[model samples]
Target: MQSSIIIADDHPLILKGLNDFLLEKKYNVLASAVNGKDALELIETHKPEIAILDIQMPYYTGLEIAEKCKALNYQTKIVLITFEKDEAIYKQAKSLGVYGYVLKEFALTEIEQCIDTVSKDIPYFSPELLSYLEVESTPKELETLTPTEKEVLKHIAQNKTAKEIGDLMFISNRTVEKHKSHIIKKLNLAPIQNSLLIWAKENQTLLE
Candidate 1:
């Protein structure tokens, strides 16, 4: 059976491209919208079997739209397509009950596979993201972190810079750097700053 779908994106080219791509794949495009608000209205009216959403949109975010869909009990499976592959975004998408996530840089074949997989009530994620998840799921020792180290991690997740974290925690810049190094070693995470930030954000909910 052909899956009925609605796509929501702010870009005209993307909206049209997606519609064309899905049409070629034999899926029915019930509607397309430029923002989350319109997407919600279309879903409520049309109730397509799936919704393909872009994360960064004006007015309301894709996550916000997904929440609304779930609340209304719309039955449409949501697939979030975005450029961001950050762990925090992935975690949020999971929490929102998204059926699939396709990175924008991946081939159209990947997107098609995701749509087909999710239409069958299964979840899908890009292979690169799957690898990241495998690394993140490994057990780590919390006892290795001092209280100050954990505090620094929490502040980092809240989008604080190293200097900001030092000021807020009433520690010296050197102390903050030492704590960050300890955190990286304990977590077995990559040495990059962005990777650390993503890890911190992804794990923040659990820390709370």
Candidate 2:
């Protein structure tokens, strides 16, 4: 039987390209969607054999859609397409039980291979991304911090504001500020909010 597939991405060109390519390959393009919400709707309506999902979207992330599919007991094979090669996202995708994770920069031929592999009940990772995993080294150390400081860092990573974190931890606002100061000093991070967020996301697995 021909495989039925749905393509989801925010870019019109990407959606069209995938649709045309798959159609030419003799696969049935069951539906296409621009975001996670629409993708989930298409999946439920069509029950396609495969779903090709872009990781970044406006309404909800591809990972969110994957989780929903899992919850609904959908048996469709999922292929996540991403521009990012972040380890945290990679680990999260694996945890979501995705059949394949394809980097956006790979050739169309690679995509074909991924689809075929996933359809055959095998997992696939794009070659470029696989190489990244092979070469990444574990961090040696994070500067030692008190348990309270670690909690503060975790809350910050979760996007909590200083006052909000203070309320959550039942600590005074002055205490929160002091903890933040100490964290910056200990980590020697750049004195920028975005820099801190970047550090948090990049080192999330280490924190865990």
Candidate 3:
């Protein structure tokens, strides 16, 4: 049987583009929705095998729908698409147990593979999203940190523990650890004990 899919996005162009693409690729597009409420209705009515959802939508966000689906034990796999490059939102999406997290910029090339992977009950996150989590270094590295990265990195450099960072951020200690790991990797710091704190000290200007 051809795999069935439900797609929803607020932008008409984006919603149409994805729907057309999936149809061109021969998947059974059960329905397309312009908002989260309608999307939920279609899911409950059609029970599609996969749901390609936009992270931002009227009535309910994709993450919210995914959580509801999980609560109801629905069989649909969720793949969230978004244009925002945000670490916190990505963490939230992962926490919701979404089947995929795809950036709109990479959607055309990657969505096909994402749907395929999700069909197998595996998760897929865009490479661009993963790249942001990787360690990169330049002479002016501190100048390149995002606001969130700078905040977390600053705390680490200040000799704050993961628990302390989590308390400050109102996030879990595990989340703090994840951020710390990403900071170390992104700064391209040598994998040695206390390397991050040392680098943090060396680059105080960037954090401050």
Relative to the true structure, how large is the alpha-carbon lDDT of every model? 0.81, 0.81, 0.84
Query: Which 10-residue window of candidate 3 scores lowest in summed lDDT?
Result: 133-142
- The estimated TM-scores of all candidates read 0.64, 0.64, 0.64
- At residue 37, what lDDT does model 1 achieve? 88
RMSD in Å for all candidates: 12.9, 15.0, 11.5
User: Which residue runs of candidate 3 sit more than 4 Å off their true CA positions?
Assistant: 135-208
Candidate 2 overall lDDT versus native: 0.81
What is the TM-score of candidate 2?
0.64
Model 2 misplacement above 4 A: 137-208
Clash pairs detected, candidate 3: 135-185, 135-186, 136-186
lDDT of 2 by residue, 1-208 (tens): 7678899999998878878888898887888999888988899989998899999998878899889888888998889988888888888987898888998878376888888767777678786785576358443225577888878878877888889999999999999999888777777664755656655665666566
Per residue, candidate 3 scores C-alpha lDDT tens digits across 1-208 of 7669999999999999988988899988989999999999999999998999999999999989999999999999889999977877877887777889999999999998988877876678887776664334334555566778789988887889889988998999988888778877776665667878876776555566
Per candidate, the number of residue pairs that clash is: 0, 0, 3
User: Scored by Cα lDDT, where does model 3 land?
Assistant: 0.84
Worst 10 residues of 2 by lDDT: 134-143
lDDT of 1 at 134: 49
For candidate 1, the per-residue lDDT at 89 reads: 88
